[model samples]
Target chain A: MDVQEAEQPVKKAALSKKESKLSTLTRELKKGKHYYILMAPYMIIFTMFTVVPVVVSFFLSFFSFNMLELPKFVGWENYARLFLSDDIFMISLKNTLLFAAITGPVSYIACFIFAWIINELTPKVRAFMTVIFYAPSISGNVFFIWLIIFSGDTYGYLNGFLMQTGFLLEPIQWLRDEQYVLWVVILVQLWLSLGTSFLAFIAGLQTIDRSLIEAGAMDGIKNRWQELWFITLPSMKPQLLFGAVLQITMAFAVADISMALAGFPSVNYAAHTVVTHLIDYGTIRFEMGYASAIATILFILMVSTNLLVQKLIRGVGT
Target chain B: MALFQHRRIIKKRLNRSIPVTIMLFAFLMLFGMFMAIPLVYAINNAFKPLDELFIFPPRFFVRNPTLENFFDLVAVMGDSWVPLSRYFANTIIITVFGTVGHIIFASMAAYPLAKYKFPGSRVIFSIVVLSLMFSPHVTAIPNYIVMSQLGWIDTHASLIIPAMAFPLGLFLMKQFMEQLPDAMLEAAKIDGASEYRIFWTIVMPNVKPAWLTLLILQFPVLWGTNGGDFVYSEELKTLNYALEQITLGGIARAGVGAAVALILMIVPITLFVISQSKVIQTMSTSGMKD
Candidate 1:
């Protein structure tokens, strides 16, 4: 008690900027030490699963790694080969870009249209409509979609339905034939995107500034068409950006559909994604180094696209 | 003056109406069919035996209905790639713990990041947000290498731990946590509660809806483990793996495969029904927007 009384007067005299920061930091730490302990386990797991894997993959990219043989440092050879030698790699990259370009916007537009229509409906109807779309996303019932689309035999659901409705003369080998397989993959992805994207768009619409619509109305804008073009769309820019980025990444990175609809070696690799390619070579072929190289390229491409999208979004905003 | 006013009213009402209503209706019907047709087939056929499932023109409604498929689920499911029970158990384990662990850890990390801003806070938070931009599929190779290094292949750690820090959950949780009043936490702190104690006792009760939201949102993904190289071990397989194992059996077992899909949809659909409100709210909060 005696020591504390003497120390307060000395400490209370004044503090330099550095001392003030030191004291503030000390106080913050003392107040929040328990939060750090709580966060430690999660941080550890995040680092192990996410951060460490990223680092290991980066290093592995430099090595010519086969699972059986120890990784040997090859130093840019994998990247050089990916650029100079690999034709399939380039095909995969092109396929992914085209897929993203097509599906990304179509699905996003679908989301907006769906949300707009649902917003026009009454709440109960909107909820029911939401359930109709979102249930599939929730169930993720991939197996059933597989069943509907790819029934290889004459009696397969899609083939049978198309024939019965007279859309085709014969059953199509949707997965087996390479020429038609990419479309099949795209169709499945479109369906999945519809559910998630529509749901997200609905949420976004709900968050919009209702007053902005009113303001637009006061400016003599009274029609739905005028409202959408001038007020609604601009207000939804962030959500739109989020959906676009998400859809593109998911589109480029899609492997599950290819895996489900057409298994490995995926019908002459027609539906092969960069992801599936990495998994196939790194995992199945056990070529870790080459897989890492492919993956690094993918990482670079995705990050670059994100940067460009952000720039574009910024432009749109301003 | 009356004539001019009447003309203004007509012009206002006319105001260049759009004619896409018919097209919108057509899109609605097409999409509704696209979404509902699969589930209808799964359920309608689930109740039908082998003979009806194979019938030509495959009638929309089942001609014969039976509990035979449900009973056969246990029997035929066992005979597939891995035993159905093992894979189902695996799926259950991954879904339950992976989701629960995610909510807990993400909540903990989310609280400080959302409510408290320390030095390096924005930087750390941005990194988490950045992780969300990169799909997990892109990281599969890297994660595989890391998992192997830890000798964690063919174990629950591979499936469960990585899922715990998933960026979407963290982002959503952080956003939601920020919406909560800081006074609630402050009151608990003043009452002399520990941080963990405050989270579990004070914060968790408030966040029940979010946890429930995450549970329903995450179950399908967690349970859909496949029998790939990264997850082929007996202890590591999920219900999806079990389903794959069955379909991989020659043509005779196709019936069993359809049955498993029917079963897989049950839990997720059930979860969706129970947490319908919370799921909707979470979607409203987190779904894409400006």
Candidate 2:
């Protein structure tokens, strides 16, 4: 044993010398070949479906292509038109930003807050509350329920309630009116937003070590707030980061709800979002290039916001 | 010294104040009602007699509940050119294939990513992370182009294959797999287990909770899918698309719409109820406490 231990330093010293990058990489590959095999199936399919399409979308953004004709090399003309010339695109952009600003941070914090609060309850109650919170997200097309509530006629629930209470003389057009459409859409979006992230937060809160809280108490962590701020938040960084990504993506992709609730091109485009505009161009007009440009802009915006949030999350307990 | 010890005991017992607990309950109840009303309304509407459904100051509760709407749904669906059973079959085939494929492929990918130290893993993971930020809408046009080029338009492959590599599944699986102890893997390695055997027998069984979570997540997405832009044939269309058509049949079909909505919602919610305990249990222990 002594002789083997004495020889280990000599062996390590010989291997510590500079080696060519190619040789080292080849050696590493040989050592980890099984991992490569395991990853191959998913990587291939993911590349074909996800990576290739993203690259194609980026490439298509620079050209002027209708579905029927060959793509023309317009060289940034589409993007220039999107930003400088198209008025509706600008409106869509502003509406999208406003939606994201309200829903993104608010929904994210709401998920964490509700998860935290729910964690303090009995196990049975916790499970029940989780289902209640998560139901809106999973129930397919149930946002249509909101449409019924916000219907323009007096028979609509919201209007009916208001009339009965003597709040308004006439039934208001809640969804059709420009003033209320965005707010209605936002409210529904927030309702649906407490989804996967909320589940993750619940799981995350559950995962915190009970012993750590005891340790904190022993260290004079005085109150529940302090215990939460120091012990709970820092430990669940992975779940927090996961929840943030889900919420951010959900916030930016607000087209479906707006389309479903407010009607497409919502009463003078008050509820028009970047994604809806992309859909209009891509599907309705078949202007693939211009649509690609809109998609690229959204992609960049989401990525940048994600990066910024990630940076901020890194300092959670510092 | 005795007083100090007594104060410590009080502090430990009062992890939360009674008022705070009451306030939290109140807040949860308020939001809970906000969340519950729409769903409860849908369920209540499903059973309401047609007259009750259309009444002004629309009743929140059904005065006379009946299953006539469900029967009416069956009658309307019966009149369609294609059989309702065919649509149900189509939906089941797509959902099962899509969800099972996703769980398998995602876990396969996530295992290597979380457990192995290899070249390009970091780059690949970052790509996965980046993909999570962009909505699928961004890729829809290009994906359609790719689909047509591959002659996958109108084929079930268009739906199933794309869902197989969903980034969220991979992300969740990887995060869960990271919590596994490396020493356990090493012990398996020492026992002459092949990597495949290790992953299949050891790793897969350990991550059962994540499997359920992925199922709960992926099933609903596939279940609600209307076959998107690719599918065109009536026979190949899903139940959701069929339901959408029935719902759009307008005021004449409102009762049926509510019934179909209830039908669409029941399966996923049931799945959640069954799997939620495991999901919550899994997630509660998922935080990396370091």
Candidate 3:
């Protein structure tokens, strides 16, 4: 009886503690109920469209599902096949990495440099230049104009120009030839790449105070490069980071340009990318499980690379 | 004497050297030309007569321009089973609903996220930032399943609903809203104003530039969406898809295709030009806070 009495108070104590924590959470939620209400519409749709799909993709990566039968558990077989057996995937991974490696950094620097130069212009010229630089990106689906330029015949612009100049005796199939497809794709991608990040950089440049440059001059900064490194870069670190995120994502996701210009499944899969591979398996082959695994890998690659870049960007001005 | 001597500082020409300035201008002109040429060609191609289009040593500028391609485009669009207006209606429906809903919802959400110090706010914002790092292609298959489950596969909801939650608009809105002073909100609260009233009457009107900025960004995206995968019904397809079909009519239709491409390109560019200053103003405050 005495032992039961002692244990009863202990049980009550634990129960009361848990209840208090629960009550505190409820109290906090009640206090912020209006905020919750305000955020509900966007948060609900966002979860349904964005967040839930990512979680489902991760889960489905472990199962073999074709939307016909039950999703059968496959463990690591899909991933194993992707790594060891799928030669096309390896090619795609290589192509995607190469594409991202070249376009990502080049476009990022180009965006900043162009914005910086354009910023130095008079306001009238700056706006004109902004529109000129930004026109390619905003002009939707006009990338096919590149097709007319690179069209594999003498009637095509490049071929016509080359033949007219006697630079080449014959027209080259720019989009068809394996040797030129990736580079052609890269060129178009870069042309379209000075997009959101460029605008952001221009805006970032505007936000930098004028006094900082004058102060830097008095502090014995030698040149424009020194001023940029010590003063301008540190001041716009936020925009730099923002631009990095936009560029990195656009860089890694290079399927649309490849598909539009080089043709889907380009000669020998020369322009094949991770996203195109995902599209192939998911839409064409209907191999949902394998495609999900590919997506999971891509998701990991993008997120990890962004985290690394963010870490590196933190050291920019220091 | 050196310390007391006044240093002349020209604000406009802060750190310019003549040779460097000349070199910069030359570089700018070269790169700018590379960027401008294709756009120029597309516009010139649209105005070219069919004969001029096919001429050997294809010209960049039209020597003799005509509206024949535009007339041909109308004729071709007239011949389709679905009228051109149906596609126009669909595109309008998608873009208007998507852009409006995105602006309203993102602003509403950003208010609490920017102003309130509540539980789960940090976590929610972090998720949004993380979502921006990856493209939607990764979620395509799963999203297809989701759309089918919701019976939104053949409907405009598939396009409109997903677009409303596009993380970029929300991110920008949040950043811009953070710059709004807390004292303003506090003053409203002292006047016994409710959160909803304070938000609707006070916060929104003050952020007009941000709204315009979101419009400029979101308009082009929704305008150009072809509704490729989620939509299947012929009637439900967008203007972009229809135009794309016209362009696919091969070499004989090149002039008409250029006309279509020109029409497609002009709307968004025009919108950007009209709103350029406002967009830049909003973007000035769109800096991430670590």
Instruction: List the candidate 3 regions with Cα displacement exceeding 4 Å.
Output: A1-21, B1-14
Using TM-score, rank the candidates from best to worst.
Answer: 3, 2, 1
Worst 10 residues of 3 chain B by lDDT: B1-10
lDDT of 2 by residue, B1-290 (tens): 22112255355534555566667779889998999999999899899989998887788999989999989978877676997767888989999999999999899899989988788998999899889888898898899899998999999999999999999889878878988999999999999999999999999999999999899998989999888989999999998887788778788888887888898888899899999987776665433222
Interface RMSD of 2: 4.7
Interface RMSD for each predicted structure: 5.9, 4.7, 4.9
- Model 1 regions more than 4 Å off: A1-31, A141-144, A165-167, A195-197, B1-23, B57-60, B77-83, B287-290
Give the Å error, residue B215, model 2.
Answer: 0.5
Error of 1 at B126 (Å): 0.6
Quote the true-contact fraction of every model.
0.50, 0.69, 0.68
lDDT of 1 at B52: 76
Best by TM-score: 3
lDDT of 3 by residue, A51-127 (tens): 99999999999999999999999999999999999999999999999999999999999999999888877777888
- Residue pairs in clash, model 1: A238-B290, A239-B289, A239-B290, B81-B245
For the predicted complex of model 2, DockQ is: 0.48
**Model 3 C-alpha lDDT per residue in residues B129-155, reported as the tens digit of each score:** 999899999899899999999999899
How good is the docking of model 1, as DockQ?
A: 0.37
* lDDT ranking of the models: 3, 2, 1
